[model samples]
Target chain A: MEQKSNKSLWWVVGLVVVVIAIYFAATGSPNPSSVAGKTVKIGFVAPLSGDAAVLGQEMQKIALYRVKQINEAAGENGTKFEVVYEDGKCAGNDAVNAFQKLTSIDGVKFIIGGLCSSETMSMAPLADQSQVLVLSPGSSNPKIEGIGKYTLSLSYSDKKTGEDLAKALSSYKKVAVITEQNEYNIGIRDTFLEDIKNYPSVSVVANETFPKGTSDFRSTLEKVRQASPDAVLLNPNPGVTAENLIRQLAEMKAWTGYKLFGQLAYLLDSGRAPAGNFTEGMIVIDAPNVNSPELLAIEEAINKDQGGTLNDLGHYYTASTLDAVDLITSLITKDGNDAEKVLNDLSRGRFKGHIGDIAFDGHNFVRITLSGKYLIQNGKAVLQSEQ
Target chain B: MVQILIYSFVMGTQVLLLALALFLVYSVSKVQNFALGAIGAGIAYALYFSISAHLQIVWTILLTIGVSVVLGIINFLLNERLTRKQEHLFALLTSFSFAIVLESLISIVFGTDGKNIIPGILPVYEFGVFQIPIPGLITICFGVMIAVLLFFFVHFTPWGRMLRAIAENSFSAESSGVDSKKVRFLVYIVGSFIAGAIGILAGLNTALTPTMGFQLIIMAFIAFLVGGVSDIRGTVIASYLVVLIPETIIGSLEGVSLNWKMVLVFAVASILLGLRPNGLFVRESRKS
Candidate 1:
């Protein structure tokens, strides 16, 4: 009985080896191109949890929705795409691990995300080392401009938003700054401070940095108010913290003299809703609204699936993530799962999608950007001008 | 300076409420019920939603109490199981795990976004250079009331003595016919109620967060160690010390921002602990 069981096991092992050998021989490679009617696995890394979870969840929904659209459009016998998601937690260390696992273990040649700047910057080295192409949909850290050959960001640089914001505040003599001590906020703050130097009339009277999760910023607001600035730049992480700061600052009736300015975070209606009308008239400098009939229609579908990501996270991220998915899937549909070709085409090609006609143009990051001026008018953000 | 001082005390009161919650459970169970923060957060969310549903204030308060009691019962069971075996570390771990689970549930239910129990700009009263929000004033009043009441209860009342006796030595207290099991259960119930009230106040004061209790619990624990863990009086003083010291240091310094606030507080705590290992007011036991 033991001898018969051993013979049966050997037969099964031999049959598995033969099947795998035949599969490789028939496909001529371990992973066949999309053109050959094979499934392509794409890795997605995003916050998925932590403070930036809303953004990450929205990005994930967008990716999954877009992939589903592509798969549906592809039809039977066409190349199907599968997305393997890993929670980056919006931290550098966590992103590196996610990137490593995706590249080494999952054998994913292409990955989208590390939406937060820290995630993108940290994964750049590993992505380059593993020869995997990383396309970031939402990271805007100016430092990410030339992160790596394999890493490319579709999102606008903080340098553009900062300079635009500084230019917007050029009329003010005394500007107070309250920056959240995080990668994304730090990037915007440093850039804004540097650009504000261009205007000799402006002087940052109060520059304060608060740690993440500092809910009680009443003292921070009081300190900033004491500076007596004509304009105050509220540079904090988006969502809850930003809403908290705006509300706390607005609570002091006497602290209403200064004009409030924010970055991409101000574009979010959900973030500002808690403070009610407090955030009205606040100027925001970031990506201009990425509106297109095609994207708008897709966003509606995604909102149905994710409940309210498009409305909660707003347009910039949703548009960028949609464009990212379109960019990669198009590249996969054309050149197959070749990371080298994808990187090359991504850098040089002017791919038209949700965020308009854009490309990297031989640069590590995209050359085209929609960073512009926006104002909160009557409890809703309106694009004032496309800079 | 006045405004900074006002805000510091406001934050100090929040830490004090959390410390008292910790002290209540620690007194009898001899285990750090870290879930007190999550319990506070969970109950706060419960109250906020109940109020949002347009329930009457009385019903909302009653619902909040019911939720708090249920949460307290769950927390009691979690600690009671391990604490009976005198597994203090395991009890702490179990409570910590419960804290994580509760926070995750809150996040799942409410999302990570901050919700305002009272939306828009809060009303504030001016006292010369200091502008104090109504909630802050209320918090300060309540903090003092609870601290004074707790101090009196533990030092003067029979029930308080029973609680303290169990805190010192549960086995001996039990041997002396103290009904320690019942007392510990009662302490957990009271502790959960306190946690729930603090949660509501904190949610009203600061933007409600899923991890609000987690942050408060850490601060309370530090104060618990800094003040003597054996007594509520020590915890009260240490809460003010831990909160005020960092606020003052950050306010006074030019380069040091609120980013370094926690680091400074931790350093100050380390130094304080170094000076008094058993805590500020806890004296060394004389073995004669």
Candidate 2:
């Protein structure tokens, strides 16, 4: 009996030790030399391989290019940067897992990314607790404004886009709206409805909400068609959902006679939506980069190197991502790895970005001084008016 | 109201195709084939691949239907092998695992970004107050034809009567010279073939996503349960009721949200099932 007990005790001890070793191995720390003043490790979380991969890939390419240029121009005492790319997959749970891996395993204090709103929102609480600075290039959900002091965005909030969309559709007395259920889209929808209420002349006749990844809008479109609204507002993330909605609307014959209005996602120009009568005459409200000659030239050069046009979807996002890299690099150079100080410096500093003067308000949202209501004519986005 | 009815018919037909396919397998094999959706999705992806290669639409669909038959045979063979080992739980899980594997393979080959099977917009047919897309109209017609053919085959044909015999008592049917294995195999093939047709119609109307069929199966099961799991005919009737009433209600009401359509479906199914545990249309004395 004594010998049997001893054997079981030995097995238990071995199993515990094995488990401990596995845990440490799975979450092992980065090499100390990588962050010991030799390099600035910036953690990145983006949808690298999923449905939203096109935007993430573009952001990645632009960030890397900007980093290379910055590092090449730096003198002695300038820190070389290393970006640890984690695939967020544009979902909340995946973003949290990626965030934990970067902060705990990589020990990265400064992070850039979470291109999608769901990605950033999931990482916000953790970033706040760890005092890690998170500067997102594309998350525009208004709810993100209060996530954390450490959380900031380089793009304008969805509030502005929603208001702009409402104003553009004010001429139509009765309008139908189909919105995807996502943090960013929900924010845009709430604000758009709120703003549209200001114009009593406009009344929303039909409103429908579908879950993310929904492709069939036939029944919903039928509902909208039954209402015979003057216009239709389609708020879908830029990709398959948007294209499917447009194609199906055309199928239902609901595409005709309805003035189409969309948020910035439509302006990505991803080629997912075919260039024809369906896309023609559609008006999109997005941040303006039409007046930025210098940035446009840089984007042209990058596209040449990329061997593909990367800025088909709003070039403003690519520009913002590059600016984020530049801003982080400069902040680190000035404040040396202190996340709080770097964030403070970022808030105080003003810089000229591709989309015009880049400055954040007290809540860390970028202020938009330039925007455009673009007209889709002959498959190309033409600037109709600048605001 | 006419527009709502037309839209309901189109949408309900789409659901019925999947439900009846599930019903066919369940009645004979006593196995809830979760992979039915994945089988259809895989064939749809094949159709997309063929179209992308510039094949004619007719050739693409025919080729994909061929692929569906092969997949159905493989699924049934695997179930048969597993059942022989008395691994009922494993057989059931195999259906789910098969679906995941198929979806993963699709994601790898076609990519996570969804594809539009049709190259361009399809025109709509308008008559009086009703407007229906060409694809939607075709789907309704195909749905009716398949349902009628299935109903007649099950009620009047010898092979189908043997299938019913196997469903009632497999051991007795086997002893009476009914080839139970052959009947099950045929059921899977026919079911999967119809699944393939529905998949192509759905892909044409909406778009193709790796996870497209997952939600569809949920809706199909809801119809299955509501119509009485054992009665394919009842399930077919319930499918239209399940999709149409809620959709039309949500479509016509000004303030009602589209998201509630599923909720209404779930609620209707729950109420019907609670009142009739054997199924709203299922006779307690029926064998299946």
Query: Which of the numbered candidates is closest to the native, going by highest lDDT?
Result: 1
Question: Model 1, B157-226: lDDT tens per residue?
Answer: 9999999899888899999999988988888888998888788888889778899999998998999989
Task: Give the distance in Å from residue A85's predicted Cα in candidate 2 to where it truly belongs.
Answer: 3.0
Cα deviation at A161, candidate 1, in Å, is 1.1
Chain A TM-score per model, please list them. Answer: 0.89, 0.87
Per-residue accuracy of model 2 over B1-288 as CA lDDT, tens digit each: 677778788878988999989888877777778888888888999988997898897887678877998889978987887654657678878988998999889988887776877667766788865678788899999998888988888789997788788778778898999888888888989888877888888877777888887777778889888888777678888899888888778877867766677788888788877777787677666566
As a whole number from 0 to 100, the lDDT of residue A349 in candidate 2 is 71
lDDT of 1 by residue, A1-387 (tens): 999999999999999999999988987764444455778899999988777787888888888888988999888777788999998977899999998898888899999998989999999988888899999988889898777889999888888888888999999999988998878899989998999999998998889999888898988887777778999988888778888888887788866677988887778787777678788888888886777788778888887876765675677678889888889988887788899988888888887767877878877667865577888999888988998
Please give fnat for model 2.
0.65
Clashes of 2: 1
Judge candidate 1 against the unseen true structure and give its global Cα lDDT, from 0 to 1: 0.86
CAPRI-style grade of the A/B interface in model 1: medium
